[model samples]
Target: MTINAGRHFVTIDESAAGERLDRALAAALPALTRSRVKALIEGRRVALAGGQTIEEPSRKVKTGERFEVDIPEPEPAEPVPQALALDILYEDGDLLVLNKPAGMVVHPAPGNPDSTLVNALLAHCGNSLSGIGGVRRPGIVHRLDKDTSGVMVVAKNDRTHVALSKLFAAHDLTRIYQALVWGAPKADRGRVEAAIGRHPVDRKRMAVRKSSGRNAITDYWIEKRFGPPLHPIASLVGARLGTGRTHQVRVHLAHLGCPVVGDPVYGRKSRNAKAPAALVDFARQALHAAVLEFRHPTTGEEMRFATELPQDFSKLVQSLNSVK
Candidate 1:
C-alpha cells in the first residue's frame, strides 16, 4: 500500500476479503469517512488495478485486489452567503460563541436548503473559516437541534475545531440547560443514568434502552414548580449533561415520566390538558441551553457564558403564574 500525491493505492489482504468496496476503502484510508469513500466511488474517482471503475459502494472485493482512489480537491461550499443577523456573545481568531435562536437551522439539509447558521457564518466570517470538516460544514464543531435555542460555539480554524471536539468528547466542558417540563419529579433533584439509542420501531425517534444503547447520564434539579404545590402542572428544571448523546436530556427526562413541554416527538399531549393555556400554546420544546463554560482552545483561559430565557419562554412562565 502506498500513498503518493493525492491518490491512495491499496492491495486488499485476506483480512479484507469479501468486504464491500466502500468499507474496504474506509478501513484502508482512516482519514476519510465511510460517506466520503462512497462519494469518491460514486464520482468515478476509484478504479481497480487495470483502470476498471467500480461505481457500486457495496461491491465485494477479493484478497490481493489492487485499487487506486484519485482524491479530488475539495470543492467550495455551495451555500450562498446570507447577511443574516447573529447574536454574537464572544468572538476571537480561534472561535466564536453565539446564541442560536429557535427555528434557525444550523446547517443546510434536504428540507432546509438556505438561510442557515452556516450561511450566516460564511457571510460574517467571510474567508476566515475552517474547512477541515467539509465545504458544506466549514466551522461547525458541535450542533444543537434546529428548534433547541441556546448558546453554541463555532470554531474559526481547524486547530480550534479539533481542540473543542476533544474537550466535548472528554466531557470537560460545562453545559447547563433549563427546561419547562410537563410534570414534576418526585425528588427535588436526581440523576438519570441510562443508555440511549435509536428507537427500534420508530427510526426517527430516540429511546432509552438498557440494551443496544450508548451510555447516557443527566443530572437534573427542580428550579420552580407551577400550579398547586401538591400536584404541579409543570416544573422548571435545570439539567446538566454528564454524557452528550442525541436527545440525551430529552430522552432521560421522558424516561423519568416528565417530558419537555411542547416536545412534539416525546411529549404526551394528554399532560398538556392540565397546564395553563399559554404553556400548552408554546411551540417547540421548552428547552434552552442557558449556560456554557469551557477553556479557550487557544488562550487556555476559562470562559463562561450565560443567557436569560427568550422572551417567549419568559412570557409563558409568567402566564403560568397568572393562571388562577
Candidate 2:
C-alpha cells in the first residue's frame, strides 16, 4: 500500500477512440480495480470540461474531453499511529506551522487511508481541528507536493480556518522555495511570467500556454551551477518561487530550457547528459519549500517559519558539487 497517492489526470486518446469511459480508464490503469472505477463513475466523480460531473461509465467518451480520476492510495496494513515525528516550526492556540517532510501524504484516500499527515494531526491535535472544510478531512489551507518537502500551516478552529484560507486565496501568504535545476538560466534572477493551465495534449501535466489559463508567475535566482569541465555544461542550479501552482517551479524552469535535475517529465535524456551514469541515478526533482510567512489567523500577529533542506536534496547538491 502506498503511503502517498497522487491524483493524475488522463486525456482520452484516439486509441481509446470509442471505448466506455470506465473501461478506458480501467484499461489504461490496469492497477485500478474495476469496482473502484465503477464507483467513481457512478458517483459522478468523473468530470468533463466546465466541471460538470459525468456518470454512466459505459458511456462512450468523446475525444478531446478531459477527465480526472482521483487515484486513491492503497490502505495500509496497519493504521499508522499518530506519533510520527513532525517538525513543528511554530504554534499558537489558533494555528500550527509544520515542516512537512518529503514522501508524507497530506491526507487519507482509498489506498492510503492511514499514516498520513492528517492521521498524525488527528492524533497530535486531537479534537482541536476545525470542521469548516466539512469532511474534506483536516483543515488543509494549502498543499505541498508529496515529494516536495517544506513548510505548511494548519488551522485549529473555524474562524481561524476562514482567515487562513483567505490569506492563501489573496496570495498574502509568503511562500518561498529552493530548487536544484538541470541547467542555469541566462539571467541570474528573473521573473517567469507565464499563464498555466492543463496541457492541451497531455492532461496529466500542466504547461505554460499562450492563451486560456490562470495568471501564473514564478521568480528565481541561480544559487550555483555545475557540470563536468571537459564537456562543460551547467548541469545543476538552484531557484526560488514567487507564486505557487501545481508543478510551477518545474514548468517554469523547463520553459527556460533548464528543467529540474531528475525530473522525469520536464527533463528529457537528450537535453541532459544521459551518458553520465552518476546523473541518471538522481531521484525526484531537487526542490524544497524553504519558508512560509503570514499573520496569525486569530491573533493577527505576524508569523514566519522556515525549514532546512531534507537529506535527499541536500545530498544531491553535494553530489553536484563533487562533479566540479
Candidate 3:
C-alpha cells in the first residue's frame, strides 16, 4: 500500500479481524483514541485501501484489508489571546522559560476565563504549543499560584511536555523559592516534613494532616533577620521543595509557626498587624520562585535560571530593613 502525507495506513491482521472499525483503528493507531477514530470515520476521512470511504464507525474489519485515515491538524485553543506582555527569559524549539508576574492566573478557570498565562502563551507560541495537554492547557506541565510570582517553564511540543512531566513526578528538578515570614525561626535552618491535603472545612486551602493527604516536605534556611536583635519582627528565608504539593511551602511554613508575610489565607492577623505598614500593605504572598534548575529534555544539558525580586517585593523588604 502507498503511504501519503497527513495519512496513516494500517493493514488488519488476523488478530484484528471481525472487530469494529473504530476498535481496529484504535489498536492500529495507538495515538488516536476510539472516540477520535469514530470522529474521523464520521467525518468521512477514513477509507479502505482502494479509496472506498468508510463512514460507519462500527463496520466490521476483514483480515488482510488495509485502511487509511486522514489525520487532522490540531484546532486553535479555545482561549482568546490578548496582547499581554510577557517576561521571557529563554526560548527554543523544545521549550521556553519565563518569569511569571504576580496576579496572573496560570490558566482559565470558572471565575477566570481569560487573561491567563495560557491565553498569553497561546498568542506567544501560536501553533507551536503541544496539544497533549489539551486546548485549555497547551504545553503546561505544572503551575504556580496566581498570587505567587516567579520563574516557570513551558513546553512547545509533546516530547518535551512528557519529558518535563516525568521529571517533575520524579522530583528530579530543582525549584527554590524565597519568602518573607512574620517571625524568625529558633533555628537558622530546618525542614518541614508533613502530609498535605485539602482542608476539611475550607476546600480552597491546604492543611497539614497526618491521616490524609500527600507527603510534602520543605527545607528552609533563614537568610536574614529583621527588626531588633532580641525581638525580630520578620525574617527572609529560602525554601527548597522536596515534594510539590498544592500550597506546600505556605502550609509547611505556617505549620512551623512562621507564616509567610502578606499571605492572606495562611498568615495570622495579629502578626500582620505588627508588621511595618509598608510590609502590611503588600497584597500578595511574599514568596518568589527565585531559582529553577533542570536538564534539557532533548540535549541533556543542565539548565539553571534565577530571577531578582520584583519591585514590590524589593520595596517591602526595604521597608522592613528601615524599621529594623
- Whole-model Cα lDDT of every candidate shown, in order: 0.85, 0.72, 0.86
lDDT (0-100) at residue 188 of candidate 2? 76
Model 2 lDDT at residue 203:
49
For each candidate, give its TM-score against the true structure: 0.78, 0.72, 0.75
Give a tens-digit lDDT track for model 2, residues 1-324: 222355556688888879988888877667676787888777544656445446688889777767776554454443333777888887777888899988887876565677788778777887888777655456777877667799999888888899999888888878888877655787878889897766655545778877555678887777766765444344444445556677888898899987776677777543544334555666776678898888886667788887778988787667666564
- Could you tell me which residue pairs clash in candidate 3? none
On residues 79-142, what C-alpha lDDT tens digit does candidate 3 reach at each position?
8777799999999999999999999999887677889999999999988988888778889998
Which has the higher TM-score value, candidate number 1 or candidate number 2?
Answer: 1
| Highest-lDDT candidate | 3
Candidates by lDDT, descending order = 3, 1, 2
Cα error, residue 316 of model 3, in Å, equals 0.5
Residue-level lDDT of model 1, residues 1-324, one tens digit each, is: 433436678899999999999999899988888998999888666777544456789999999999878785544447888999999999999899999999998887767778999999999999988877577888998788888989999999989989998999999999999999987988999999998765654545778875556788899999999887878888899999998988888888989998999899898664545666677778889999999999998888999999999888888887787543
User: How does candidate 1 score on lDDT?
Assistant: 0.85
For candidate 3, give the lDDT.
0.86
